[model samples]
Target: MVMKTKLLLIAIILFSTSSFISNRPVTVFMIGDSTMANRSIQNKNNKERGWGMMLAGCLTDRVIVDNHAASGRSTKSFINEKRWERVLDRIQPGDYVFIQFGHNDEKEDPKLHTEPGTTFDDNLRKFVAETRSKGGIPVLFNSMVRRKFYCNENGLYTDSLIDTHGDYLLSPKRIAEEKGVVFIDMNKITHDLVKQMGPEKSKELFMWVGKRKDDTHLNIKGARIVASLAIEEVGKKIPALGKEIRRYDYVVATDGSGEFFTLEEALEMIPLKGKCTVLVRSGQYGPKPPFVNKKIKITEEKGVSWGSSAAHAEKPLKNLDLYLCVGQSNMAGRGKLSPEVMDTLRNVYLLNAEDKFEPAVNPLNRYSTIGKGLGWQQLGPAYGFAKEMATKKHPIGLIVNARGGSSIRSWVKNARQSGGYYNEAVRRTKEAMKYGTLKAIIWHQGEADCHHSEAYREKITQLMTDLRNDLGIPDLPVVVGQIAQWNWTRKPHIPEGTKPFNDMIKEIPAFLPHSACVSSEGLTPLKDETDPHFDAASQIILGRRYAKEVKKLIKK
Candidate 1:
């Protein structure tokens, strides 16, 4: 409800060295049923956030996420309410029209019901024609998959997924193809993800009340994940719009390893007399210059304030996908730095105790309990995972709070933490959320809990529950990294009863709702000796494994 709409102005525009300092903002206007609607958090729907609400987290200031979708509205009802007219009135060149529907349209009632090929197809054509009339691109997305899996007698899933919104899915695809608009298959992607998550875990990605499950609507985690899936598809189907989304930037760092050594080099390349705009950014690029230079003038930017740089604004990009990595030794990373990992830097970043979001380097679990959150162990799974998440064009932020020798008990709310690890984790999580939305938590700690294996499940579950409540994100998912294998390692290093402990870690999902486990099977530990920590390649692969599992918890 608060985001701005895009406007196409003449080319002559210039702002500070910001990404996409164009004539107008790129607007993405969404229209559909309650599944894609803008929800009010002030009432019963407080916990129910639609995918549109979280869409902003995936984009930079160059684009706008303007959601006009409403609940319980079918194609006929939307037209009658003048919702489509209001969206049409605001249409501009270079703007996008994202259309999705069907939940309310299947009703037997006349006002809500529309036969797929007849009324539904015709209505969809109206939207495409009108959008094209305004020189706007139109993209159609099918309905999302409901979290309905086939279950056994004990309430566990026996199969993958079940088809709930049947013919509705077919209608949108046929219409998009026939009308020559971009088509995004959200249902297929979400259906596969739901099946992979199974029955019990899939419910966490939807709205589940006291025995009343609204699989059609999503909670905050569900919304964010679904939004990511939609945008990813949008990027694929609409490549030009995808390029504007993010993943590339003109960064002029203080060290001068960037595209330009000085702003003068940047300005000299651009033609300032025309309507085209050039952005100039710097970390410590000396004295400021006049706004207008030979017909060039500066314009106020969205992400860039009057005089903010990368160090000051913390590399503002409107919003970022933030994850908190907290656990023990393996999470603290003990791998040797690999040369390949050094070259794997992109949109991934780490938030340190100093509150700066810098380009993420390995040994990410530095909480002062180990080392600085920079240049350690050569690489961690956080490196690969952060890179994976950022590849979608969203700025990814990681908050590190791992301790080397901490047990599951150390993560408890009132547990004994000599270094205040748990307390510091809570403090940092609360602080980091002020800068970015708390997406999920990546955890890896079980080697120390091996000795006290009896209390492992309860302590770990309590840790997750407490963290979510304290952070005010009741459904925040936890990605548990199953401890590395130590049975094959040299004699003295392998701890007693290691197999059972790892098996117990694998069963964590049965006791928890939104949590998922990533196996460390076949992962090679440190060679020449037998420590539980993973080696450079293993840690890198393990981070991607954790990332792959978390992708299921969040999206497909």
Candidate 2:
């Protein structure tokens, strides 16, 4: 009996030891660039933190978060600089390593870059292999979308900017699938969330405070939300970690009423109780409707009648300033609208001063405060631009005065003072005054000037100067779209002088002040010798480039 009792005691001790070993804390190591790096003040000892810092706070004690991300490092640089090696040396069996990159890799600079075609993918594979070799689980996350969201006539979220570095996400996803590694699409997740939030309130989830107009990085609140999203994604993809997650409950609120509320109203209604989502129904709200008052999502839906309002927890309302969008044809758009897009534009109201027109007349014509225009089309620049800005939680008012085939010469101040294009643009600018304060002017009209390249530079410069003076906004930002590759002439008959004309147009932004150029050189749609209009993919690229330039201009 004594021997049997001793054996039972030993068995119990061994079982307890095994259980403890199995339940040991799971270490999570984060590796990436400034977007995921620990925020430390290089200028001063500021307490700003990165998304990785907030990640651990969202999980249970069973998970340990250790971020080793640095500023301005691509996948190749991270490895070449031995950053990944340092991370791997500390990793233990059963640990997890989360890799997020692609922001810096997209840089064309040779010194600090990774070519998305080969280097980016190769680096990702190496990270995965090294992690697995050390008995650690390699988890990959696609780069997050910068906080730039625009909507089309149908009011859907356009994927212009998101698609630019698409290979950034695709490479990781492909490797994960091939190697059986865990892949979390932070990009797609963020995109869906932004669409749900609409443009206005989504801005609150980004780094939108003083001196930094960085859409690539997240603020404290933005970091927290991103961390929470990452946690939720991990729980869904990795079953073993599901029970360990503490914040996975997302409450979505949809507005069934066909009429949409301002972003302000939606922000007021979204509760701070838990992870919440607010979907506004498809319909026009007022101009500069408070779309992004906070970190809440404002989405739109069609075909299905959603609920009116959802209440989770009451919170004080936050006020947000409005953003105005102005430009020409590309700004107007040429794509077909989807239900999702229309639903997302619920809060974006067009101040159409012109008479009622077809929703298709100009899907990009969103400036008139009282007139109707083409209401449904795939958005070009505005959809993506507005959606991205709204995601930053800033109030947005788009004052569009773009005319198809319009030239820069037409937009001069005094219609009677100048002939040709100047007179028409000045007249339209006068008509656009009733809409609101013209914050920015987006110009996409260099095609006509290509035919008259000899004097394009001087004419464009004068027009820009006159425009700023006339609007009384000498510092107003003027964003230009570089003419993409187009075949304006008939098949087998290329315009001999078009190339030089286009090349000269590309150099306009270099000479102008307060002006930035969005390159559409590589974004033209594949076509025969006839159709020159950009395709959906190319439009997205153009829009994203515009957003990037705009963000830089707006940065303090």
Candidate 3:
């Protein structure tokens, strides 16, 4: 009897030990670039703290934050200097590594740079392999943007950094995929947040020293915001550590009255039922709004389909796709759509007020569609792409995550490559799929990447490859639109300048696989000179072109 009792005690002890091991604290190790590194005393004395420092405060005691990121280290230099090797030596099982680099990688100087070709990607894979070997998870973040501070005629600060970092941001993402690692695009999130803040207030987030234009590194406040984003990202992949997540929250709304809820109120209201759209109202919602919620639409409207009151007790909706769209003015969907085209796409609903609610004054109805500005709108390309998939049609959902007038660099996940626009598109794509499967990715970019013809092909290829890998679908179909003919050709601006860049775009599709390019060379109307955006007529054609390419890929 005594022996049997001792054996039972031992069994219980072993079980407890196993459980403890399984639920260990998530240790996050950050690597790469000055923006993420521990800034020098002089730098910190000036109130500059890298985003990694502020990120430490967001995690509970259970999560450990160790940042080994260095200042001005490119992919090649990081490896040659054995910085990553030092990181690899310390990594343990169940650990997480967040890598953000690329700013310095694009340097033309061979001593300090890395070509976004095989070398850049190869170094990334090495980091992934070493991390995994130690049973650690690797997360890739594209670089952040440098604040250029350009505004439109209306004084709205348009994010233009995407143009600068387009090619630089693609390398790490492609490497993340080839290495089977997770990626978070910090570049895009920060850019959108800054743009939302507008030019004036956005300056407060960076370390703007004397004559330096310190857009590359974040101050203490900026670091905290970025760290919060990283924490939210990790919570998506590993739910066990969610308790330690102090930065973000997940909520559902049951009132169905189109009323908005603060982050605090939403958290207290748990497990909300019925079909409801989590409304993010039209007012400027900043990064501090506790955006880390799950299964909520974060919308602005009260009525219409997928709105607040649309959800009833009888019908419960499951699985929602939230998209984030960011680009130049075209992505903002300027100009009007013909009534005929609007009818054909009737299933699509914009975030406008109903006739009954605002008969005399429609507050949100001023714009031609919900696609104007950044708001939660119905699935556009994702919906169309899913519709094309008749046989394997999954529960169709989309998150319209986009921003206009931004360059590709604006969206890069790495702080070094901030303001890179494509990175933002990638981040939005990942965010959109959190609720469901991403059938296809539709991209309409090239004006920014066209500037540097020498590296454009490699950059585009890497961007597509990285996007596919980040979403966990390696061979996903990617559809891109060719740059439309601009009216600059009609007027005299520069002679050989535009031709070289425009001509290089024709060769992008040739290098990529399972990718199709839509021709918008002649789609725009002759009269639309002031605005280079596609008219309603052009959008239908463009949408059709996207659909056709998607169909062709699906058949294969």
Candidate 4:
């Protein structure tokens, strides 16, 4: 069967944050007869394998395939042997159970015999209800074809395929229809496949070679094909689980030293609405590239020589400009949001708490991994700045990693340490860069560092150098905004070194390359002069000013 799926692969340095993009891992429990059991072959002469043996290879790492099927066990015997109870004991919420058991149920032996309309149907319903009771999703798959074909008068194998499972297959179908469970008709799918291959050629799928006369069990090659077929159906029936299925179509070398160089070039080869998976090899890959077709889903493959994470999106993202918004409270925005400022800006997205891009709205800094609580999250300048810069053709992505009441020393010192604000900011920015190009850095801090304003210029310069070097942008444009000019007459508690700090911020453009400073000369405070934070109106103006500086820098 032709499967339609979209997949992308990109190289990324391994980190704990890589797992944050996806939800918790889910287990897929496979329960059935020997046809689905895991077989042991001491010698290569036996050469018998089950389709379930290849299941895990068909899915992503998030899915764990636990095959519980046994040789010579039917639905009745499985429950009687407490095998079903064992499966039940391990079934957790959000797990999936694949139930397929009709092979041994067709036997006349009382130990496994079950009438299709009565005991078999009852057993199927019981499995579904009990799985749901444990909060596990239950999917029923009817028994596979037994390789029985009809022959014509000429002695050549006919195209007609016979059904050996008979009414037993109808039991799972009926139970699935009645209980509202997902059902995959493996009988019909295998029947069509076998019929198309004809009698002679189809033997390669089963164990019809020397010493192995088994027609029910599949060989290694056959197991892989069946596993792929089942996974394809799962993707179509269960979208959430299906999207996690892993497959590769291309290989990439990030260093531009291999056959395929960059991700953008690989993405350009995929046809529109077509599906492909690219395997990214190890190398140092920067973020200046844009995907030519669709937004890719990034999944991290660990333990390999080259570590990587993948990202995916349905819509096409082109020329996505990314900016790192950092510093203290002003950059995080203490402004009260108005209705207009709260509205989501068109073509602007935020690298949210989950590291996925969502529409840019108020409290853009709420997604900061190192930032404070949601109460501190409010209207930030990024909303207005993105609004001023974003267009229908060119989208924008913002990484607002700032904290309130933070000192310049804290930022500079933390730049070299792990789990600190500076490193957290860099990590988040790099994650966001996987989807877009880094445009500039916006800094509006220094309030808490007023006590050390005498050397503010020197410290801020060091901070800029560290940020640019670590981010792989040696001459990246840096835009600093002057701290709020507290009304001293009404707010006498304002820091004595506030004027000096502002002077140092204003002097950034003099010596720093590709850098500028935005003026906060007339911006309004949050509530009154006593409030050090900017008001909603002033935050909007600050955003516009920052965008103006960015536009001028981009021109050069």
Candidate 5:
């Protein structure tokens, strides 16, 4: 019984030790030439960077990237200088060694140059054998492409990207196949990337900073892109290493180059309560697709920007026109959302409370952060106006932020005395601008402030001025819809200040540079013309009229 107890304790200790060893992080040792070397940010002018420098950012914390590549070092020089020896000494069980060398091997220098079939192939086999002997997995990578644009018969630079690596690219692949190790074709990968970018745009990928233009070396942007390409392959060829790679929620490219071709496909990947960012390439897309209850932020890649900045690129999508719809309850739409109006417009989008773009439907203002909740929301003018302005080619985005009974003074910039919501409106609008261009501001409030015309003109003028200044649009178009001209709860008496408020709206374009007003004349109110809100039919007409006024202002 004593011997059995001792044996059981020994077994438990061995199992715990194995578990700790397995859970430890895996190290990835990168050995290559200058193209894969870590470079110093010498000055503002120095732009040369290596692909290995950006590799760690693409991976999770479980992978430790130890890059030992140096500038102007070949397979021959690396082994001779004991750099490979240093890396080999650190190789533990279950680690990875990424080998890439060819750029400097093709050089004519005595110390750097190695014949592709003989010395180059031999050095690669040596690295693979030594890495495996240490129980470390070896993955080989061919050198990246040099951005050399070949000239056509017309003597003009064509879009074709010519390869300059020659036979040096084959040595690594041949050794990988013989040694039964995973090989990543980084040369062909970057070649395809530069080719797709074309001749002129490809210059942004190489070391073409300031007055220096070296196609053989990579800049910061180019290096990150190359690293991503390598890892994309690593995720496929090396499954264990691939599991340690970071995953993105969405990747959209108009050219069908990213993970998902369309925005809808990417959005569908989001699970409930999932925090996601959509990485989009610069291009014109169709209408913004509708998503339900998911918070998604979109980022546009202005160019081939990779690494962390690539995930948060700020350039907005082209051809998507944004219109800010702000005011009181009338603009918020109290009318019933009919079955016909309930469906989403083809090319119209609603900026939701989470600052995401979805298909514009009835109760478009339901997502307003400062406005009343869904209990007070219904059909409004935004739907009809977006429907009128949108086309198959031109997408219209609506930002509806309005309180049911908000006074004009409540919208004054930093109006602390009135507990104003001007700051919230500006914050939402600025956030919405990341998705599209801000074309116009639609206003339809003033029922609350109708009783007094005291400094009303100056207040409204200051509001527009502050909004335009804050938005950085000196001549931003403003479309004001006249307040409802009906009695409340079927009372025969109309508000005395209603006419005066409408009159002020008429004189807006006279003083404002790009402002216009739509009349509320002949528009029927809800429930036997008793309610202050316009009925569904009248709301649609009001939206159409607002669209007409907006068109005229936009033309100017």
Candidate 6:
């Protein structure tokens, strides 16, 4: 009681702005060999193990990494043991499953060895199919390289970090490309990481204590570093799971003065069904710790925000209606905040530009002067769109990833490598799905690309198809918003930019199943020629239109 009182006193003096997250933690199902598995302590010399042991520590508390990897189990043996069934049985929607197995498969044991592109590919397909069947995303990885440096008794190191696993790496790469699933080249990533450590220093990473040089298994330090690299890959290629890494803290407050304080407070007033973040300014409040249970997570930043109330807490994401908001400035949200819009918002949530889930309020996009004057007033269509669905069976959430002035060409997956705008958007979408079902992808582009009206339809269709393929959503519904017609376009400023683009949008539903486009025909522009985005009032109707179209698809 004394210790508890001390903690409560700290909570009051150093005010805590608690945010109760509504979703379940994101679970990472890890299936791999000894390189990525946990091992039992055999004896005093049992310091050797897999990197999976250190994965959870590398990740935030929200990510639950369930490592089912074993010492000698390959993909073939893992299935033979019926372990794959156990993993699939509990697999649910919005879960991430990782597979890595090659070391034992490379050995002479016929029971475990799998031919790179044949049996290996076959086994991988089963994992992918099963995971997708349960609506869970499957990720593949190659086993880490052994720390076998080609050296003699002269201690002359040469050709370090050799790829002994042979076609094992090739097999996973082929499967990933063939199936369009996310694949992490653990062998390549860790090999490069280990090579940087050098041969002598690299020994510290392997199971080489004093004299025992078992280069296969990694020690605590090696495992931790290797695990860190593997996780880093998780965020790199499979961005959806990457955003949930929780590498740092997000401060929330009672007063709307922090990065996410406003969104958090808005949800607090309502019976928020999922998690949102916030930070409050200093004020006179009771000196008592929140009656926290297993669901709550309390954390403190460097105490930089106003007052000692710079507390942050969030769990892994789950169980919400996740949407993807992508496109140009209008989609970036130029709509200003209104009282009606704010008041009507309920369990609406958004995955912010920062990849954090907060209450979906106005300006669900971004503003240049963030944490500055009038910045908090930024509003957008996501709030109203999500709110319209709040009364439905599920809670509402949006992954907002839009820019002010980007062309359609920039959204192509190949083009995303250099600028990374499209990749970031995909990453945010994946993060949002960590907690919720991805119900729809909302796009409001074309003003910038409207000039290329001839290629507009094909570009739109191709991008949508590739996006679905990569995301493993074969028939995910797409809701596109048509660009507003400006007087300049009518007066021939750029005739191709307006009517042609709008015409293409009208035909989207005809070509794609479960797809629809919302019109801005009756909607008026912001009226500021210098800024031709939708006005605050018009955004409400636009959002509702989007909701109606998505709802129709849901009903169907």
Q: Which prediction has the highest lDDT against the true structure?
A: 5
RMSD of each: 24.7, 22.3, 25.8, 19.3, 23.2, 21.0
Question: How close to the true structure is residue 390 of candidate 2, measured as C-alpha lDDT?
Answer: 48
Q: What would the per-residue lDDT of candidate 5 be over residues 182-229, giving only the tens digit for each residue?
A: 778988898889999998898988888777888888876687677877
Scanning candidate 3 in windows of ten residues, the lowest lDDT window is 355-364
The lowest-lDDT stretch of 10 consecutive residues in candidate 6 is 12-21
* Model 4, span 394-489: residue lDDT tens: 788899989876777778856443338888778888888877889999998877776466678788888889989999999899999988776432
Q: Which 10 consecutive positions of candidate 5 have the poorest summed lDDT?
A: 303-312
| Model 2: CA > 4 A from native | 1-21, 41-48, 151-162, 248-556
Error of 4 at 127 (Å): 0.7
| TM-score between model 1 and native | 0.43
Residue-wise C-alpha lDDT for candidate 6, range 327-414, written one tens digit per residue: 7767766564433444424556656544555554445664221111122224567766877777545767777767655778878778
TM-score of each model, in listed order: 0.43, 0.40, 0.40, 0.44, 0.43, 0.44
Task: Say what the RMSD of model 4 is.
Answer: 19.3
Higher-scoring candidate on lDDT, 3 or 5: 5
lDDT of 3 by residue, 497-555 (tens): 33565565555556777777666766774124434456545655665667787768767
* Candidate 3 residue spans exceeding 4 A from truth: 1-23, 41-44, 151-162, 210-212, 248-556
Residue clash pairs of candidate 4: 295-313, 296-311, 296-312, 297-310, 297-311, 297-312, 298-310, 298-311, 298-312, 299-310
Give Cα-based local distance difference scores for all models. Answer: 0.67, 0.58, 0.53, 0.73, 0.74, 0.65
Count the clashes in each prediction. 6, 61, 59, 10, 0, 16
RMSD of 5: 23.2
Model 6: what TM-score? 0.44
Clashing pairs in 5: none
What 10-residue stretch in candidate 4 is worst by lDDT?
Answer: 4-13
